[model samples]
Target: MNRTNLCIRMLQLLKARGKMNTTQLADALEVNPRNIREFKKELVLAGYNVEEVKGRYGGYILNDQYDLPVTIFSDEEKDALVQSYKFMRTQKDFKPLTLYCDAMDKIIATSKISSNASLHYMSNSIELDKKISSMIDKTQQAMNHGICVVLSYQSLKDETPIEFEVEPYEIIHYHKSYYLIGFSLLRKDYRMYRFSSERMFKCDISTRHFIHDNHFHLSNYIGEHSLIPLDLKHVIVRVYHKENGLRLFKEKYWGNKLLPIHKEDDYTDFEFYTDDMSNLYQSLFSMMDQVKLLSPDDVRETYLNRVEKIINAYKG
Candidate 1:
């Protein structure tokens, strides 16, 4: 779209294919010869040398020694990367990207920003776990190459490890966890595998490949920050004050599916749907006295019992 993006895409094309002619680059990038020249100029201006060859089946090539720095980051991309880093730091199973995390802050400062709001300094010293990182690499390779993956997943409830082959469609980051969404041959259906908690003991790219379902839409399968369908149960919470649960529901990061039922000057009734009652209960429990549960007697009872246990623990 923009000059920088076009140049970057061209660089990516050249990097992938080693070299390409004017026609090949034009056809691959879906741009004209003039546009390819313009993209090359932009890349050259950005400190990348684009060599042109003048022969049959010769076009342009990126030099092997030149490395591309991550220079162009929009506000949205910066926010996404920051959030991912924050999530990565929270996972004890893997070491945090401490240097990269610090570098992100420096990049944000150097980059132009329209807002004057204070940024959250989430500096932490943790390193990524090698075993888990290896799984991630294998999973990414499977997704990129359209190949099946063999994984040994260990669930907390299960003693023995479960090994299966799956066709990875997408990798999702929900809350503070990473999940691989794919069609599982073991389950004979589409499912999501959470990498942080479920724990992948072994992951290998298989020679077997699969045709990605073009009709599959990730947003339709999982909500913006939710991994599963929210159609199973409806949860209602009444907020007596605006600064309480109301404020949290209004924030974009809290998920946008919270429906306001009754809106008044001082009080508001909000409805949230989720299949996982345990998760809903945990979220509501964090709010403490700010909210009241209205429906689903079992959920309410569970919340109350948990609260009682907490209170008794403090008292004891």
Candidate 2:
């Protein structure tokens, strides 16, 4: 038989039997074992994840998720379906589209759709950073299968890399950065790890499944803290609304722990939370005449003392 016909037969047989070693496939197709291995390579290049098993039950099998029921769609029907998918692909929220593509990939693969056709119709709208995309893909797979992932995390300050064994809850993209929000086994708490600063090298799907709290929400967790945790401290600052400074603060820096603005004539009290006080102080100091510390006696006095020192140093 021709190579194309033999591959089609091999796929059909694997789908029926769930798996087949090279010897079995070669015998069934009346071909050399090397031919079977070559066919597996071709399947992989065509976007099918053909996984290899080792030891006594060694064989090549399609990924369990892709062992889909047979599908029959005419060329015209597929064209129409892809057109509709293209329209939905243009929508903003990507999860739904991602899900559709995953299922469609299986359906089309089972139906023997050409790779070029699949690529043309199902192109992604969003472009992810290639350096991080592989890690993101692995983490996502772990999330779907309820597996534990080990990541090598490098912080901005730390020279050495740290290992994190986490149960990934979600991958969030915020402000041109990606974050993996997961339950850290080491820290024994829910934490958000920066994906770009981390490398995911291994994933182990334990037979032990996790009991997920239905009430656990990513937004609620992030709402309680800033995007990056420095040294958290509650702060209250008074700002004179000179040239709409309050509006600018609201537009740019407004987030968690920002208490309602208390307006008194020309000044407004801006109560918020911050982890990095040095950065916050520098920002406030630059606005010297327009902003003032409202409370937290020590922080207020510190700002005042710094201003005094700057004034003294520049004495005429």
Candidate 3:
């Protein structure tokens, strides 16, 4: 069979069933196993990554997202864009979070979401998984049809093969990640699940109608730590030593919002803040010694108290 027919048939098969390995695909395509290998090379040549799974549960997965370049700008251009966005989000007076989202939507509407968005934010950390290409396509179709969808989520709260019958509402692509915002049947509340790290996905339409009178906006339902809420302004952090805690600070942030104030007495100060104390603490604790809260007594006290507990816990 021609590769075109083969791909079409395979797409249908995958839509019906979540995933299929090399052997299954080769057999279904009615070609020699060796030909299957050649076909995959051809697919890659045509801009697709035929992913190979290793170990017991490993199999051949089609990565359609990587099939082609979907953006007008090059890699450097996109990185600069993300950096600028990070600054806008974390700035002291970044108003109209929705505008940011809207602007991003417009900027990325026609472009490829894969290359532009960074699903994993872990800097230099060996932690990331390439999301299945078919999953997002199926999700888009499901969302368009207003059907129930399933998710295999492992983040923040739910961490299992969650069979969620959800009414798909919106697709949020922020912080170099894509999320599906919807109403969950199990929780009976709104939740946003990341498209990445999704082990598997399947969707079906239900005859039942969703109660959509008092719609809880996605912007409000998001966590406080997010730049959307925009409560706390900015803070000025003064470092003691010039090269002190620099690594920790950079590792914590992407070097967008935290700007250098000055270097003093072998110490330097950077300015950045957020309403989410936990995020703030994470950013601060990474700067083991050189980091200090120059202003905002409350934030300083919280850090000191945590330090006290640590000290008491490890008393000599």
**Per-candidate RMSD, Å:** 15.0, 13.9, 16.5
Q: What global local distance difference test value does model 2 have? A: 0.65
Q: Is candidate 1 or candidate 3 better by TM-score?
A: 1
Give TM-scores for every candidate, taking all chains together and pairing residue i with residue i. Answer: 0.48, 0.40, 0.41
TM-score of 1: 0.48
Clashes of each: 5, 0, 7
lDDT to native, each model = 0.65, 0.65, 0.57
Give the worst 10-residue stretch by lDDT in candidate 1. 113-122
Task: Report the number of the highest-TM-score candidate.
Answer: 1
- Candidate 1 residue-wise lDDT, 1-316, digit = tens: 7666778889999998887888888887777877987777667667785766433455688864512343677678766765554454333324434544445444533453211122222233234477766776788877767689998887677797899999887665555556687888787677778776357777899887664443344444553234565555667778767555567645422223678889788878888766665567676777767778887787788888988998999996
lDDT of 3 by residue, 8-63 (tens): 67656655665577678778888766665566555655765455443345555654
**Candidate 2 backbone clash number:** 0
